[model samples]
Target: MLTTNRLRQQLAQKQTVFGLIASVPAPIMIEVIAYAGFDFVIIDMEHVMINPETVEHMIRVAEQSGITPLVRIAEINAKEILRVLDSGAMGIVIPQVEHKEQVEAVIQAAKYFPIGQRSMNSGRPGIFGRDDLADYMERANHEIMIIPMIETVQGVEQIDEILSVEGIDMILEGAADLSQSYGVPWQTEHTLVRQALDHIQQVATSRQIPYCAIPRQINQYEHWQNKGVHAFVLGDERGIAFRALQSKLAQFPVINTDRSQTEL
Candidate 1:
């Protein structure tokens, strides 16, 4: 049966919901993030090279674990979007959306008839073809989300137009890419980058659609919270795993080995 999009629910209620990028390419990791209490998880396809079957299993695991699963699609094309959605992703994050037309194209590719020209097919998301096609199409159109990424200066500048296109449920700030695009190169908090992000946030806020962002520095979270940002992607799985190991590694005493006749 179709269910409510919890991330959308959280955003609609203006609640601050937290999530992470599931980049580990393991269904267990997806389950673990949900068990860890994240409200949603983005199964990252743009960076990770997990095969199609694995992606479906991860989505199924997410459903089993009770986490809203969204996909960061490799590109803004019909085939990729449709396949991911058919695989049971509740939403999608399209990167480098620089113009209103791109956003419209994504909307066209994601939603069904009367809203978009997406090809019709039944899959896990449609309850494996058990649900009536008409009902599924109606619910799917209303439930699925198309979130555009604003990563470049051009995208930020076209923010108003992009958000103006209907069916875009949220906008994500690609901080790392935005920083690089602005020539700050890894300095996400650089003044210029901050200005662009602030403008994007301002536009989203005014439009009443949720704006999402990921914070690299743990301390930087409060700034978004203070700005009333309601949605957050809490960094990628590998980084989270690495930082966890790094923290644990810091706690143990260092091991030293020396081999010498006198020492022995």
Candidate 2:
């Protein structure tokens, strides 16, 4: 059901917020993430195969666990945007946004009337028609976030125009894809990628828009913190889990298995 956007409220108050990308499609994983103290979870539909039903289940778990749920769609498809928001996601994160018109179209699909032409329905976001329609529309427009990711070089070039879009609530930087776009595939910390990211951050900051950074390196958290960034998406949950499991195994010594030594 639609509710106040605590993540947006935290950003408004200049509070630092931390989140993780949920590539693992399980609602139980989302519950664990929320319980683990993440401020938000980007239920990924871009790089994963989660269906609409699973996404909604994850959102429900997030709500129950007191964490914000945002959906990261692959592109600017209206149907995808509408479905996720209707499923009760507090925000939509569109990736590879390279133009102002793209952002405009997203707003059209994500926002209600007078803001955009988002098709109306008394779905879960409207409290299943229990809440007054007009009040729900007003609250949805005010609370639901329209976040665009600036990943490509073209996106970085058009940052100003994209940010100029009235409905954009926040901007997320995509260093991994930006690195690929810069011809340094997977080199998220390459000099060129770093320069582009810094430029995006500077522009977003100058325009008074909150910039969300994904720290790929050890010192990057402090780096963005010193620059006054309030939002961060730590790497995806899968990678974090893999590393933790690897570390746990590394704590034990391997058993010797030489047959010759055992032949007494």
Candidate 3:
């Protein structure tokens, strides 16, 4: 059964929420993050190899692990959105959203009629064939989260119009991609990129909508925290694991992999 989105509640209360990206499509990893007590988990199908069945498994784990589960869909396709929602994801994070029409399409595919045009199929989240789903539409619309990524210069410029669309629960940023769009590929800290993010914050603030930042460095958190941004996405599974392992391995000397030196 679909329950109220606690993530939504916390955000409504102006509490800062933290989450890690799910780059590894494993239920165990989902449990680890949940037990570690993050506010939510993003099931990343965009850059990860997560299939529908895998998403369902991770959602099951998150349900029990005490974390809100969201999926970052590959694109803003209606069927893809419906499939994951039915699999029990509480929200969606759309990537590379640069136009108001794209935002409108996402809202339409995510919500039921009277709000938007999501198809009627109570497959799993609504308990698979519930006769009262017609009645559940209101609750469903209320609980589902709609988040769009502002990853391009065009997206930043169109923030006001995109945020104007109804049913958008939150806004997410893609620093790396935004930097790329600014002609500074992978330079998330470039002044131009940083300014663009602040612009997003400014626009979202004007509209009274919550905005989330994915920090590329540690100090970025305190900066955004002062701006009163709603949430932060720290890192993904692979990056998290790699950093931990690298830290632990730092204690031991590395076997220099310079084969040229050893060739003699």
Candidate 4:
């Protein structure tokens, strides 16, 4: 499994980090994404309908196939964060973080005592009951990443303060939501939207924090990469499926139901 530190090192080296949003709940889909060569794949719990039991197996499979597994938990809930961290996620991406207090709560719950109050549990991260819980709790806080999504206008306004908060390692910009908040939905190139993004990158760069941008425009990836942005979450599972479907449909002259699965 790719540790968070390893991913951080890769980002520090200015490597173009690639990742996928695994909206599909099947554990087999996770293995496929791993073999498909993404740096990491996030098991999206915020929007995707994935149960805890199924997600655990998916994380295990992704790790087995050599891809780092990240979880975008539903919200800034500590109890939920603890469950996923204990289940052995390489890191976690939290959503809708608008204030410093919310960030603090997330950090306290995601991390263990001495740093935060993450309760001890014998799970996969502790090697399924073999490793000592106390030592594991102490060390787990240092390794697991807690990335907060900076999407709302308020979040953007408080970006600097949020970045300065301890135990937060990364920030993921929610452009669509931010745009909606700005009263210009889906307008990535809107001056206000661009300005907010610029501010985020500038502050993050100055503070030496890793910030991620989900590029909707093709050129934006290169644009941000050149601007010292390392973390890039590339595509969604639905888009990948659509592309594959289109590619397969292009080859077949007619709708051949009997042979469709075979051809695919």
Candidate 5:
């Protein structure tokens, strides 16, 4: 069912919020992420092969578990955006947005009549006709977030114009793709990539748009925090889980010794 966007509310309160990119397509993972105290979760459909049914289930779990669910759509397709929003995702994170027109298209697809020409339906987000239709449309327009990712050099160049779009709720920095766009390919820490990200943050700050940073390095979170950034998407769940598993195994010295001996 539709509810207040807790992530937006936290940002409005100037509270620092943390979230993770859920590459895993499971409702249980969404429940665990919410229970673990994350303010939001970007359910990745851009890279992960999660189907519409699974995506809807994950959103339902997120709602039940008390976390804002945001879906990262593969592109700026109206149908895809409409389907996910109808499934009750609180926000849509459009990937690789490089032009103001792209942002406009997202608005057209995601928002309602006076805002944009989003096709209307009293689906899950509308509480299946439980809520008044007029009231639901007004609430959906206000609560549903339209977030765009600035990943390419072209996107960084057009940062000002992109943020100038009326309905953009927030801006997210994609350091990995930004690095690749700069010809460094995964060198997200490269000086040039860092400079581009800094530029994005500076522009977003000047515009008073919340900039969501993905802290790839250990110290980067504190770095962004010190800079007064209120939102962060701490890497993906798969990497987090892998690291946790590796750390757990490292505690068993006997097992480590046996593995080393077997390799020898």
Candidate 6:
């Protein structure tokens, strides 16, 4: 496996590693994120339409580019977790991890037997295709990271127990989902959501596990950094496109003039 320095250091220092998400699933976009200098580009499998082959290709490109590739599997199943890990994702983010049991289930799905129950395959990223199944399975389980998303109120309550799990290396706060759950809307910095996140970060800091925030909000970065948050996923593929398109459109003379005018 290519060395994942940024991710490794974040885990070690409990410092935040900023990155982006890829909802669009195009390999070419990997180049954009890599060149953009994000720590990682997660290929989303939760809501986006990405095939296994495409994910593998994206991971391969990410490996070549030195940008860590992470996969957020939609479900908590062994087959799904194995598919992504075998494709060479440096990390796996499981959604809706609200309790210790659910986190344990994700662990089993992403890790090998004894530790968990992820089926082993030396297809591309294992032993250079030499097919050393036994050793590969053993090492892969220990080396791969399992990150759980705490998005619900229930998850917030159980954050400590989930982070305390042996194989769980990191936590991600699903601000949008969490906000909606609390009936406060999907703003990341809504007071209620921010309070909830502060609590989560507190627990993470005490336990020394990395907590990756979604989207890098410049306003909140310093505060979170001071609070021991090291893993920050800056934005997603679609978000970047939308922002860039808006910025570019605003540069047009007519568009700028019209947009800047106040209605009489």
Clashes of each: 0, 0, 0, 0, 0, 7
> How do the predictions measure up, each by TM-score?
0.95, 0.97, 0.93, 0.90, 0.95, 0.89
Tell how far residue 232 is off in model 3, in angstroms.
0.8
Error (Å) of candidate 6 at residue 90 is 1.7
Please identify model 1 stretches exceeding 4 Å from their true place.
Answer: 255-264
Model 6 residue 249 lDDT?
90
- RMSD in Å for model 5: 3.0
Q: State each model's CA lDDT, in order.
A: 0.88, 0.92, 0.89, 0.82, 0.92, 0.79
Between candidates 4 and 5, the one scoring higher on TM-score is 5
Backbone clashes in model 5, listed as residue pairs: none
| Number of the top-ranking candidate, with TM-score as the measure | 2
- Find the 10 residues in a row with the least total lDDT in model 1: 255-264
Residue range 19-134, candidate 1, lDDT tens digits:
89988888999989999999999899899888888988898898888999899988887998888888888998888989999888888988899999989987777877887989
Ranking by TM-score: 2, 1, 5, 3, 4, 6
TM-score of 6: 0.89
Candidate 5: tens digits of C-alpha lDDT, residues 91-156? 999999999999999889998989998899988888788889889999999999999999999999
Candidates 3 and 6, the one with greater lDDT = 3
What pairs collide in candidate 6? 15-230, 16-230, 16-231, 17-230, 17-231, 17-232, 112-116
lDDT of 1 at 154: 92
lDDT of model 5 at position 91: 95
Give the winner by TM-score: 4 or 6: 4
